[model samples]
Every structure is written in structure tokens, then in C-alpha cells.
Target: MSASKKARAAARLSAVQALYQFDMEGTLMATLLDEFHRHRLGMEIDEEKFEKADVAFFDDIVKGAVARREEIDAVLSQKLASGWSLERLDKTMLQILRAGAYELMARADVPTGAVITEYVDVAHAFFEEREAKFVNGVLDAVAKSVR
Candidate 1:
């Protein structure tokens, strides 16, 4: 990938983690973002280095996903299978859907395919290919609704 693409991909992944934290802890957005900036983005832990992420992109995804969560969740809920609710989803899975849905709804600059692929790749980090494909299907359904 090109530099910006690489940075954005990293940002998308980190945004999912940040959103997961937000969901579980209800951390104040400002404090959560500040913590990521100071300690997490591209920072090393346990002797492993993270990819350098686009700070602006990271902030936008985290803030936008949370800020527009109700709308995002509505769309996600619609896309889920029958008998499924947003609450039934894994927390990480919910954030992946939220972040991807936010981009599809708001970021016209990003192609639909890129958004789905990026989040699908993000899904792979925490899950098996089976779950990653689940991410793909949900985000694909989400893209169709928004874009």
C-alpha cells in the first residue's frame, strides 16, 4: 500500500480498538483520544512496534463513530440477520461495523470497496477468516444501504 493508505489502514485498526475501549469502559472521548495519542498510536509495547497511523484519520473514526453511533447502529441493526440485535454482537465486531458504517455514510472520498476491505482486514486482526468474512458481509450490506 501507499503511505497514506498504510497510515489509514493502521488508523482504522486502532480506531476499532479505541471504540472497543469506549464501549466497555465508557471513557470520556477526550481522555480516550489523549491516551491513544500519547501512548498507543504507532507506539511499541512488549517489544513489538505498531504501524504508524494517521492521527487525524484515527481521531475522525473514533469521534465520528461515537458521535453518530445511534444512526450507525440503526443501519447496522437493519443489516443484521433476523433475530439479531446490536447488543448480540461482539463488542469488537460492533466497533468494526460502526467504524466501517461511519465511513460509508460520511466519507465519500473513500470508495466503497476500500472501506469494506479495510475493515475486513481489521476484522482479521482479532478473529479468524470466518469472522473476517462475517465482517465483510455486514459491512457490504451496510455500504449498500448508505452508498
Candidate 2:
């Protein structure tokens, strides 16, 4: 991957984690952004070195997802299986969808394919292939509607 591509991938990964923390812990937006910028992005944790992320992209995804959560969630909720509500989703899975949905709805500069693929990769980090494919399916649906 090119440097920008790698950085953006890292940003998407970090943005999902940040959004997950926000969802589960109710961390305030400023606090969430601060924590990620200060301690997580590109920071070594447990001796595992994180790649340098695109800070602006990271901020946009994390901030945008949270800022427009209701809109994003509405789009996501519609794309879910008929009986599966957002609340029924695993929290991490929800964050993946929210971030990906936000990107599709707002980041027109990012191709729909790339948005879906990146979040599918992010989903892979925390889930099995089934969940990753679920992410792909949901994000693809959302992209189709929005983009």
C-alpha cells in the first residue's frame, strides 16, 4: 500500500476503536478525540507498535460518526436484516457500521468500494469472517443508498 493508503487504513481502524469506546463508555467527543490523538494513534501499546494514522481523516471519521450518529444509525438500521435493530448488533459491530455508514453518507471523496473494503478489514480485526462479511453486506447496502 502507498503511505497515504496505509495511513488511511490505520485511521479507519483507529476511528472504529474510538467510536467503540465512545459508544460503550459514553466518553465525551472532545475527550474521545483527545485520548486517541494523545495516546492511541501511532502509540505503542503492550509493545505492539501502531502505524501512524492520518490524523485529519481519523478526526473526520470519529467526529463525523458521532456527530451525525442518528442519521448514520437510521441509514444502518434500514440496511439491517428485517428484524435486527441497531441495538441488537454487537457494540463493536455497531461502531464498524456507524463509521462506515458515516463515510459513505458524507465522504463522497472516498470511493464507495474503498469505504466498504476498509471497514470490512476493520471488522476482520475484531470479528470472524462471518461478521466481516456482515460488515461488507451492510456497508454495501448503505453505500448503494447514499452514494
Candidate 3:
């Protein structure tokens, strides 16, 4: 990826982390976003590249994820096994789904392939090859279903 794309990926990862924190901690949306801005030195991947524009982009992704969460989860839940609910998925994987689904649903400017590729890259950063493949498969299914 180009430098700006890499920067955007990092920003998305940070947004996912923030969302995961909120999911686990029950932090208010406004408070969590404020905390994210306030603690940039600690939470950010690259302080030098952080800008107001990136912050706004991250906010857009997070807000979009929250707004379309139920629809996204329903799409995901359909792909799960008989006993599994969306909440039963791994936290990191759920974050990936929410982030990917948000891009798929809300960002008309970003091609579906680009969105899936970016989130798969994000998954690969932390998961093993097999898990990344699983994420890729799930996201592929989600893109097709939601389209």
C-alpha cells in the first residue's frame, strides 16, 4: 500500500481499538471519542501522522459502524453456525466485521475490494494465516450479502 493508505489503515485500526474499548467498558460514545483524542500519545500508532482529518475519518468510521451495527450483525449472524450469535464471535473478529461492514455499507467512495482488503490486512496484523483466511471468507460473504 502507499503511505497514505497505510496511514488510513493505522487510523482504522485505532478506531477499532477504541470501539472495542467502548464495547467492553460501556463507555459513552461521546466520552470515548473525547478520550481517544485526549490520549493520542498513548493509543495512537503514529503520533507524527495523526491529524484532524484522520481523526474525523476515524470518527466517521466508528459512528457509521455504530449506526449500522444491527444490520451488519444480522448479515454476520447468518453466516455463523447454528448455535453462534454475533456476540459470541471473537472480539477482535467482531471488530473486523463491524469495521469492514461499516465501510461496505457507508463509504460509497471506497470500493468493496479495497474495504475488504484493508480489513483483511488489519486482521492479518494480529491473527494467524488461518484466522485471517477465515476473516477474509467471512468478509467476502458479508460483502456479497449486503450488496
Candidate 4:
């Protein structure tokens, strides 16, 4: 991958992780962003080095997703099938959806296909192929509506 491509992929991964942290820990957005900036981005953990992320893009995604969460969730809820709701989704899946939804709705510069593909890649990092497919389907539905 080119440097920008790698940075964006890393940003997507980090944004999902940040969103997961926000949901699970109830950490404030500002605090979480600061923590990631100060400690996590491009840092090594357990002897594994993280990719150098696009800090500005990472900030935009996390902030945008959090700022517009209710709207994003409503759109996501609609895309879900009967008897399934956002609350029923796994936490990681939920974050992935939210991040993808935020991008589809707000990041006009990014192609819709790119958003879906990136989040599916993010899902693959934490989940089985089935979950990645689920992310792909939900994100495709979300992109259709928002893009």
C-alpha cells in the first residue's frame, strides 16, 4: 500500500478501537483522543508496532462519529433486519458500523465503496469471516441510503 493508503487503513482501525473504548469504558471523547494521540498511535505494544496512522483523519472520524452518533444509530437501526437492533450487535461490530456510517454520511470526499471495504477490513481484524460479511452487508445498505 502507498503511505496514505496505509495511514488511512490504520486510521480506520484506530478509530474503531477508539470507538470501542468509548463505548466500553464511558471515556469522554476528548480524553480518549488525547490518550490515543499521546500513547497509542504509531506506538508499539506487546512487541508489535502499530502502523503510523493519519492523525488528522483519525481525529475527524472519531469526532464525527461521536458527534453524530444518534443520527448514525438511527440510520443503522433502519438498515438492520426485523427483530435485530443496534443493541443486538456485538460491540466491535457496532463501532465498525458507526464509523462506516459516519463516513458515508459526512465524508463526501471518500468513495462509498472505500468506506465499506475499509470497515469490512476492520471487522476482519476482530471477527470471523461471517462478521466481516455482516459488516459488508450493513455498510452497503448504509451507503445506499446516505451516499
Tell me how many clashing residue pairs each candidate has: 0, 0, 0, 0
RMSD of each: 0.7, 0.7, 3.0, 0.7
Off by over 4 Å in 1: none
Compute each candidate's TM-score over C-alphas: 0.98, 0.98, 0.84, 0.98
Clashes of 1: 0
Task: Provide the lowest-lDDT 10-residue window in model 1.
Answer: 138-147
Model 3 segments more than 4 A misplaced: 41-53, 81-83
lDDT per residue for candidate 4 within 98-130, as digits (tens), equals: 999999999999999889999999998999999
Q: Estimate, for each residue in 58-128, the C-alpha lDDT of model 1 and write its tens digit.
A: 99999999999999999999999999998988889999999999999989999999999999999989999
Q: Model 3, poorest ten-residue lDDT window? A: 44-53
Pick by TM-score: 2 or 3, better one:
2
Clashing pairs for model 4 are none
